[model samples]
Target: MTRDRFSYLAPWWLPGGNAQTIWAARAARRHFGPAPRWQRSRWDTPDGDFIDVDEALHASAPQAPLLVLFHGLEGSSASQYAVAFADFAAAHGLAYAVPHFRGCSGEINHAPRAYHSGDFSEIDWILRRFAHENPSRPLLAVGVSLGGNALMRWAGEMEQSATQLVCAIAAVSSPLDLAAGGYAIGRGFNRVVYTRMFMGTMVPKALQKLEQHPGLFKREALLAARDLYEFDNLFTAPLHGFRDTVDYWTRASAKPVLHRIRVPALALNARNDPFVPAASLPTLQDAGPSVTLWQPAHGGHVGFPVSHGPFGLPGHVRAMPEAVGNWLLAQL
Candidate 1:
């Protein structure tokens, strides 16, 4: 793995990590761009539940590389990063798809099990199916945040076999060490702001899941849960077959197994990312020869807003997707 100097820098106005992260995400959501005419497909799992995939098809480029995106915790196809990547795919004429994790695509999943960060079995099944269906097209996967960690785990688990399934893989702002990230997000300012925002949606969805399968977990405990660790322990960990949050986090983290990844892969994280700490990021010696670590100084979380030209005009919320897209294509 090469610890190359990343080429992304936030504008002068976006000073802190939290500021850069929040501002860029909001800005992207507000700005107008080409929204993909998404063709939604529901694929049934071996279990009774189903997963939804939103695709932007290109029949003209019959054998174009398929870009599969895996969204973060509580994220969907319409997520800011997901939409940005969809725009990039449309502009480049690449076939694109965003696979929503179980219970994440508006509809709650039928099974007792919900998605988690270390759910590589689900990732394996999804990617393998895509490979089988589009045998002619090279598969390239990009996962954001939670999804990224899960995808990296899948790559490591599959090892050399991963190369046959996908030509290249990229992860954006993934918390490689889930324990550190989980701890970080649950404390101080992150807890009050980010945790509250996530819980606003997650808690409701979890309750709905409980309604689907009565006696799943204790209702009072679930409601009392304040942060991710508490919430994961109350809902996510138990539902996903984990003993507790620590067990889930330890087993799910991608850092311990990063050296096992054999495919041409990129793990892009910002040194200033609020969710993922710079100390937790993997070094060149920590990864295999196939991995490249792009730890830029300014990009916060998945946010990579750029300032360009002489005047340093600051209107580039789409920079990370463009850079990631270019890197993925270069592997082919």
Candidate 2:
């Protein structure tokens, strides 16, 4: 697929439109139904508190390969994409799991730490535990947006030797450069749309934490902050031990780690992604033998819908689950 810049500017309602606006608007609709049924469990971390993982099983076969799914920032097991993927997996007799990041499982983490776009340690913890417990079963992974970046980074750092159980991996619309992604979204119309919605959800959480812990975060800075950068700089960056947002973005972006992956991995990026700048193209030099950077002509962040029906139906999004599921299953 050719990475066309003009394609990204197309309107979202258009069939196969790759504009970031269209993608964001679809996600904003909230028309998707409740997540599919799944079994929820709390995995006690080495830190004492729990990280929640939701397992959706299609069969009881002891040797069935398990596909572990992860959601985007602030998403839980109930995210639309996660649930849709689970439903797709069920039809194929594939078992899956979605792990909620540290404080996102309706219960605040005991420590001040929360999840960010590039937190691979949490993934490492989950995968190791899952592999150790299910020695005979193979493990695969897929993540969306922020979660995608985390999974990709984890797979890359593994060097394909760390885990004999892992087979294939897929990541969609992950912002390889945090600073660039933030800058792209922090402008003109997009800035308002993104910041307002994101802050509305995040600020309340920060306030709740402040209420519980009293002095855990910067009350004044968080109160005055209006964008993700400000919020992260004051609350997320400091709490995560970064000196500044720029520093965090530099270290947390997955671009530096892409070349290290040794397993079959696919990265899907949309040039029209309003959140990530067009300048941050696939670093061809960094790609390895096992990596396939699938830069489609257009896909607004995650809106790869194949139709113009109500709620992006009858097209790409619906078809993607089957495609992704089949691809992963083939790898196993």
Candidate 3:
């Protein structure tokens, strides 16, 4: 694994980790830039649920490279990062697709089962389908946050087999160790703010699913849950067939399987990311030969805010996606 491959420089205004992370999502308006026109495709899963993919095509290339994106938890194709990447792909004449996780595609899934950190079946299916359907175009993939974890896990699980399908893979702000990440997000302000934000959407969705499918979820227990750990313990674990939260986290964490990844892969994490601790990251020695770990000092989760260049001239604001797109382009 290479150590000097990635170096991130943040904007002068955004100093700390929290500032960079929060500002990108809350304060920065232009970060999303102009929205791209997308064509929606519905894919039917084997379990009867459906996954929605929003595709943005290149202007004139039948065999242009394709980039498949996986969004973070509770995020959809409309997410700022996803849109930024879609726009980047379009501008660079590359085809892009953002796959929405189960129950996140603006329509509630039919089955009670939804996506989790370790649920790699959907992504695997999507990659295989794309490879089969678009044999002429080279394929690349990127994932953010929870989606990143799942992508890395899937790549590692596939090992040497993944090189046949994907040319390269990149993951941003992935919680490699689920337990540490869960604990980090459950403490102090992160618990009060981020955890609440996550639960605000998660609890309602779980309740809605329960309402749709009676006897599938324990309403009382789910209602009482206030954080991710509790929610996962009550719903995510049991629904996914894990014995408990610890078991789920242990088996789902990508850290253990990272060394098994054989395809050219990059894992980017910020040292001060609120959702994941630095301890969760793998050292260069521990990483697979094909994997590169980019631990920037101040990216703050998936946020890598760049300045508008010297003299405050207008420049690219989406640093993370731009960097990722550049890296993937180089790989191709």
Question: Over all chains combined, what TM-score does candidate 3 have?
Answer: 0.95
Tens digit of lDDT per residue, candidate 1, span 240-290? 888999999999999888999999999999998889888999988888888
Instruction: Find the candidate with the highest TM-score and give its number.
Output: 1
Q: How do all models score by TM-score?
A: 0.96, 0.87, 0.95
lDDT scores in order: 0.88, 0.72, 0.84
Q: For this target, which candidate reaches the highest lDDT against the unseen true structure?
A: 1
- For model 1, the stretches where C-alpha displacement exceeds 4 angstroms are 29-33, 57-60, 308-314
Enumerate residue pairs that collide in model 1.
none
lDDT of 3: 0.84
How big is the positional error of residue 277 in model 3, measured in Å on the Cα after superposition?
A: 0.7
- Candidate 2, 1-332: lDDT as tens digits: 11221123233455343343354335432223334577888888887768888888456467877888878877777765676677776666677888888778887777667778777787788888888887877888888878988888887677777446488888877787788888777778677777687888888888887876788876887889988889889888877778989988888877788788887777777766767766785656767777777666666666655553576443335345566667678776
By TM-score: ranked, best first: 1, 3, 2
Model 2 worst lDDT run, 10 consecutive residues = 1-10
After superposition on all C-alphas, the RMSD of every candidate to the true structure, in Å, is 1.8, 3.8, 1.9
